[model samples]
Target: MRTGGKLAWGFILLLGIVHWDFWLWSDRTLVFGFMPVGLFYQVCISIAAAIGWALVIKFAWPKDVERWADEGRDGGGEA
Candidate 1:
């Protein structure tokens, strides 16, 4: 894999690790005086995960497989 792909995968791994939020589990603080800190952290994590998946699709997805899948879709014979 390329360096950019590796970095993207690393970011996804970091997101996975941080999603646990063990430190925030017992916190009683409220964010913006409304949402709980833990809930806010989880919401941020959810957004990060969506962005991370998009990055993985852009960077880590196999180009050759993509080509293979598209080969037969253009009215071609054997893919």
Candidate 2:
């Protein structure tokens, strides 16, 4: 899959897991929070941050993996 798709799926899975934890457990502080906002909200914010980071990296540093593969095919030393 493309980077964007992978990121979207990752975010969805993370959110789902967080949601499950928030609903299934009463004491979420140990896993998801240490502040006033509560565990679920804290984890939502964290997921947002991760999405932002993924976007930045995906858009800012996109490269062709095949280029690296081609370079390695010749040998391991600089020409």
Candidate 3:
């Protein structure tokens, strides 16, 4: 795989790690006196997830899919 593919896979793994709930016990702590620490952490993870998805789309989108799209656009879909 290419570097971008590796990065995209690593980011996906990180997202899985983020939801493991190891910080569930830290809920008693408040961040900025508004939301619980666990919730805040999850929110940060959400943001990271969004960024990761964008990176995957930008860098790791499959070449085969693109080729198929182009073929269809060129009226090569009869087969």
Comparing 1 and 2 on lDDT, the stronger one: 1
Candidate 3, residues 35-71, lDDT tens digits: the string is 9888888898899889899888878878697678666
RMSD of each: 3.7, 9.9, 3.7
Count of backbone clashes for each model? 0, 0, 0
The TM-score that candidate 2 achieves is 0.32
Q: Looking at candidate 2, what is the lDDT of residue 42?
A: 59
Q: What TM-score fits each model?
A: 0.79, 0.32, 0.74
Report the lDDT tens digits of candidate 1 across residue range 8-66: 89999999899999998899899999999999999999999899888888888887987
lDDT per residue, candidate 2, 1-79, as tens digits? 6777677667656665665445444543444334434555656768776875676566544477768767747566775
- Model 1 local distance difference test score: 0.89
For candidate 3, list the clashing residue pairs, or say none.
none
The alpha-carbon deviation from the true structure for residue 4 of candidate 3, after best TM-score superposition, in angstroms, is 1.7
* Alpha carbon lDDT at 4, candidate 2: 73
Off by over 4 Å in 3: 69-79
Q: In model 2, where do residues sit more than 4 Å from their true spots?
A: 1-36, 74-79
Of 1 and 2, the candidate ranking higher by TM-score = 1
lDDT of each: 0.89, 0.61, 0.82
